[model samples]
Target: MKQSAYEAAVGLLSRRDHGEKELRSKLLSKGFAFEEVTDALTRCKEYGYLDDSRYCELMLRNGINKGWGPQRIQQSLKQKGIADSRIQEMFLDLDIDWFEQARVTAQRKFGSQVQRTKDRQVEMKEKAKRFRFLQYRGFDFEQSNYALEQLSL
Candidate 1:
């Protein structure tokens, strides 16, 4: 009369997408044996129900919406157990244009005030803070610099 591990896994997956490691861990925590969890995971993969590539795409789209830069995206995916090789292949030549994105984000958060500062020291300090914010959003050094420069103009 016991429910199958596969059934439980399917129910969990139906609620939301999960990375492989996360799924496996959840099932194990729920008392499913390792073999059963592995079998269920394999079936999920066979049915195209679990795919890191799809996960990557979803993460990328979500990151774009949240104004996250490529470096942050890369780190996030890696944390989800996505392979480095796949990450490179998937993101190679990907151009998210962090500079322009940063400018837009800055404008939305702290628009003309950034440009209106007459004190050179205060202006530079504000600019540096803005640059740090963009960097924290996962942009690289060059992208952050370009974004801060564009905002000044």
Candidate 2:
């Protein structure tokens, strides 16, 4: 027999936290009716089994552990269907220093050797490469430059 919407949602939550949109999509894909899905979601929220704020906090902590910057984390949260207002609120209260994160990420990746190059052109190229890498890692230019400076010192 097919599982009920509540059962399916509970089972999914047993494995890991899921955003409301993600859980709803999964339930719909499993052939649950729209009303049933909505009801299940509401019940879960009412019971404290589903919370976007908790999910956001977990994602933010995980991202920081993995050396991800705020930009990337925000983008990821948005993609996961988290509301912009919640995301902003979480960021506002977060104590993480993004520039320090950038520095640590750079140190972890390239070590303090970023300033060893003596040739001006080669140094420029190296700095450019580091900039691109940090940018790809979701750091802004100012943060990236600050990281490079820290490495030079």
Candidate 3:
């Protein structure tokens, strides 16, 4: 049985939400014509089944839950076809303190490593490793440093 583009789109959305651009790409890759994909997207929008703002909000919350920093979250949202202005607006409205988030993330990741060691060299190495992990998590130097400081306490 050949399913229509709208049917396929709804099926995909039933499993999870998707941004319009991602949905369109998936539909196109499934061999639907451009016009079919476009129509399906439009219909989905009309039904309020496809909302970029809702998708962005979900992604942002998911990123934070996963302990991802703003830089990484922004990049992920952009990849999902969210606008920079939208992302910035959401960020402004968010009450999260990124510095505190960084500190918490570091503590979760390296709590045991913060134990005092007789060897200053070992302590320095541990700090470096923690800093690198924070950086890889999209935290900037100041955020990472603040995290390291907090973890030391």
- Best prediction by lDDT: 2
Ranked by lDDT, the better of candidates 2 and 3 is 2
lDDT of each residue in 1-153, candidate 1, tens digit only: 987778887898898777888788888999999999999999998998887778778877788788888888889988888888988987875776667876776666667444565688887787788888888888888877876666663
lDDT of 3 by residue, 1-153 (tens): 999999999999999999999999999999999999999999999999999989999999999988888888999999999888999999999999899989888888777346788999998987888888988887888999998887763
For model 1, the run of ten residues with the poorest summed lDDT: 109-118
Off by over 4 Å in 1: 93-95
RMSD of every candidate to native, in Å, equals 1.9, 1.4, 1.4
Q: List ranges where model 3 is wrong by over 4 Å.
A: none
Clashing pairs in 2: none
Model 2, span 1-153: residue lDDT tens: 978999999999989999999899999999999999999999999999999999999999998998988899999999999999999999999997899999999999998664465578888888889889989888998999999999993
- Would you list the rank order by lDDT, best first? 2, 3, 1
- State the local distance difference test value for candidate 1: 0.80
